[model samples]
Target chain A: MELAQRILVVIRFECRRGMILSRVATALVLAVFPLALVLLVRTQGGDLETGPRGPGILFALLPGLTCLMCLLLWAIPAIHSEVEGSTWPYLAVRPGGKSAVLLGKYLTAVAWTTAVGWLGVSLCAMTMRLSDRLETWCVLGILILLSALAYGALFVLLGVVFLRRAMVLAVGYAFIMEFLTGFIPAVIHRFTIQYHLRSLLSQWTGWTPASLGGAFHQLSLFSPWPAWGHLLALLGGTAALLAAAGCILRQRELIKPESE
Target chain B: MDGPAGTMILLEHVTKLYGTVIGVNDLTASLPQGAYGLVGPNGSGKSTLLNLLTGQLRPTLGRIAVLGQPPWNNARLCQRLGVCPEQDAFYPNITPLEWVRYLLELQGFSGSEASERAEAALEQVGLAETRRRPLGECSRGMRQRAKLAQALAHDPSLLILDEPFAAVDPLGRRRMVELIRRRIAEGKGVVIASHLLHEVEAVTDRFLLICGGRLLASGTAEEVYALLEELPKEVRLRADQPRRLARQLLETELADAVRLTGRDELVVSTDSPGRLYRQLPQLVDRAGVRVFELRAAEGSLQALFDALLRIHRGMKILQPRD
Candidate 1:
């Protein structure tokens, strides 16, 4: 086979074998999981109101929730594992280049993250089309996809910095930092990709967003483009982080201690 | 290996410095295509050398080329290289069948070929029956086999195995040795970094004996060892009149090679032990000497290894004559 073909084969193979499980994990959490959770909540609450003025809290279920959950729980373990399995050595040895390898996996994570997140939000949107909020839903969904790219790179950097405990750190940042300070002043909240994501979706979904924990009204912040601009910057930042991390990994001195 | 690339690996004054400590220093060696054993003690830098060669670790100084390409960051270079790390890190909740399969899959094997090769490779390493078990559940030896299996499944022309026998039981060691031996016989070049000299000496022809991150000696096992000399070779003589035989032998030129290690046992070191042993009985009979013990002093490989270690601890290089 030609060298380029071999490189492509390796990159695709890396994507499929490395992240397939994490993608499956993402699907379970973002799509089937929320569906199950909603059913369970409604079982005891006795029939959710779906007829008149029924699109109340259901709007909050769209766009950013599944993306956030998947990034936090699923992407955390996935990125952190690149080190643990000793698979990096194998990947580093291939001919396609580490950037290509990282790009392939990053693409896989983004696609899976977007697909599962969209799947759930689309479900809730289908039910809420009664309120003519399709435009709001569409805009919010695009914003979530953009925000996920930034978060994905941030998590990838976490993996490179903390090889063993990257998972714990990613999870902590997701559940704690993002969840806590996401609704502060635009300047402060800009640190988080999810803050911009929620800002873009909160009001249009008929759900209230509180970056300062109920301090802000429903999406009443400044326009969403600044957040969008910052999101793109984050996207570039993720790529840069991945490139730097890949370089470090390339030069890293791996002393493999004799096994027990 | 792209037609051997004429150079399997080369290290030019390659050194790895960790803080003030030196892992490898001003070391240089060129490796061609063949199965070479890297035999050394715990900190002999065998693993470090392998890491440097395979692109897992970069040298702190100098240059390294695997198959004529710098081993660092060049994924294209790695396509022809395969490495089995010494550590026993595994992905939990995954089977050996699945794990090795995925690793091969990452090497760009199609689904069917990857699965088939995974099975064959696992079976070759004696993991076929147990491949379905999650790696977390596999025993230490099994995990090692799984690691090796994945490395071999890629059919890399150069296979680097770091302490391949580590953590394996005696039986497992034998199995691993056979696998390595088989791969080598098939004309695949292998580099096994290990401390078990007996194991290595038995399987490999050429050896790189590393000490203190420097190449002490590289040769056959026998050539690298310190043979017992200067110590008199004790050849026991069975004599009737012990006093008379001792005086007779001591008076002659042959006495220089003789010494008494035990009563009734006189050890003799002769340029020709065979001639002396044949002449002893005739001399004993002629002199009316009593006879009892007859033997030669023996040397052990373990003692030789220890002596080499002691000598290497302070020396920069081993004399070729030792």
Candidate 2:
């Protein structure tokens, strides 16, 4: 079968049936949050509104916050849930088959975070007359997508590496990588998906690569291919990480004697 | 009851090493496919053998062929192979009807055919009532039956089962054995790994005994039992005036083999059943004792298996220094 077609099949079949309550939760998050955010935050005058900032253009592009949300809320804990319920043995292994179960799950996150999540941002953008900011819309949506891949890959690796304590480490990584990395300056900023993504989005605010851009440039995440190059670099890097993970799962015995 | 011409599985110099540590050491064995029972203790490479046989794992250093084809990564070979792993991992929210149907579809069964096969498989495993319930809600035995249903749904030519009886209730285990026996009667091949020798003895016509990561014995259960011929036969005797009889037997020509087991019983291992049978009436009269209980203490199969296991255990104890 074609790889893309298989991935699409997995995305549809796998995402639908695993968890009933979680399915409802994702649906609610998809359908309700977009409509709710527009009503609630459009009136709030704090950093949520932007009359001088052009009535929420800054806030409309704030799905860069989903960089943080994707790591903590979606990517980090999602693996914990699957592993706790013992789904990996089915989802992970098949003889002579592609080892890209991650693409299915990663697509689920991309679907919710991009389609539903950015729709929320778009709704707030439209409510405040900030919908015409095409750069803001594109950057916000793309950043959320990148954050999903980067953080999703990291958490998937954690699930493979520390199978027993993956949940614990994934949560800690979420807090550390998502919350704390932005505080570190210079080269350290590029290491966190949150930093690279937000920095790229802040670029849509018409800022230079001087602060965010120069830091991101140091990571070799950007080559001559420019933005798409960096996207593929991040993708290729994630694939390499997954390759390392495949080595681990293939080699390590899942059921050790001590437990049995 | 099938002859050697019906042999089902073959392994040559199969050694699976987990890094520097050994998993299944150099093991070689072959047996016909008709309801073969694999008896081994914990960590005896039973599960590893089943995994290697069913294509779930590739052997590290040797060739394994199941039902006349290489199993590892060969989809065509696997279409004829089925496995029931000991692991408890299945879809939680979907009914067995859904999951089993999907698995058959993966094996290339058409939609209607897959559904029919799934229903028949579930019914054969006696899980019809709860086939439509989400598997996560089913009892452990029901879930195990559901797994068995899917394995059989494809009508696999060879079945490799890793501890299929584990965690199953007595009734379920009995039904499972019957199911396997039915398969054997059809001349299909089955390799079932079990810690319990007696449990498998009834279902399987052949035995492959493994111990301490190596093959210990093979062939029919009787043949494996015959490997323990060196162990003494335990003949139990009960008679009036047992002490007096024991005293007289201790002094008799073959007396060195007898031991007083209870107040009125003697357990004897005899090299010559003929001499003992010939002299017993005369000995009873001479000792003024009336003979009562006289029988071999353990069943023939159990005695043979125990004796062989003792030797394996001895080898295990001696292996560290070697």
Query: iRMS for all predictions?
Result: 4.2, 3.8
Error of 1 at A189 (Å): 4.9
- What is the Å distance of residue B317 in model 2 from its true position? 12
| B181-248: candidate 2 lDDT, tens digit per residue | 88877877887888887777868757777776777777776554443433445568898777787777
User: Clashes in candidate 1: how many?
Assistant: 20
lDDT of 2 at A122: 66
Per-residue lDDT, model 2, residue B322, is 12
lDDT (0-100) at residue B91 of candidate 1? 62
lDDT of 1 by residue, A1-260 (tens): 53344445544554545455665765766676545655666678744334322233333343446665566654554434555566555555555434444555555566667777677656656644245556645765676577568777777667656767877887788767676666455476666665556545544453443423455545434445654565566666777766776666555554443311
lDDT of 1 by residue, B1-322 (tens): 2324566777788998767777777887777778888877888787778777777677889988877788766666677777887767576667888877666655667778989999999998889899899777988889988888888988888898888777778877788788888878998888888787777765686778787888876665556543333223456665545667777676655556555545566666665444556577777777787787665554454444555666578674654463
Best by TM-score: 2
Position A8, candidate 2: lDDT: 59
What's the true lDDT of residue B296 in model 2? 62
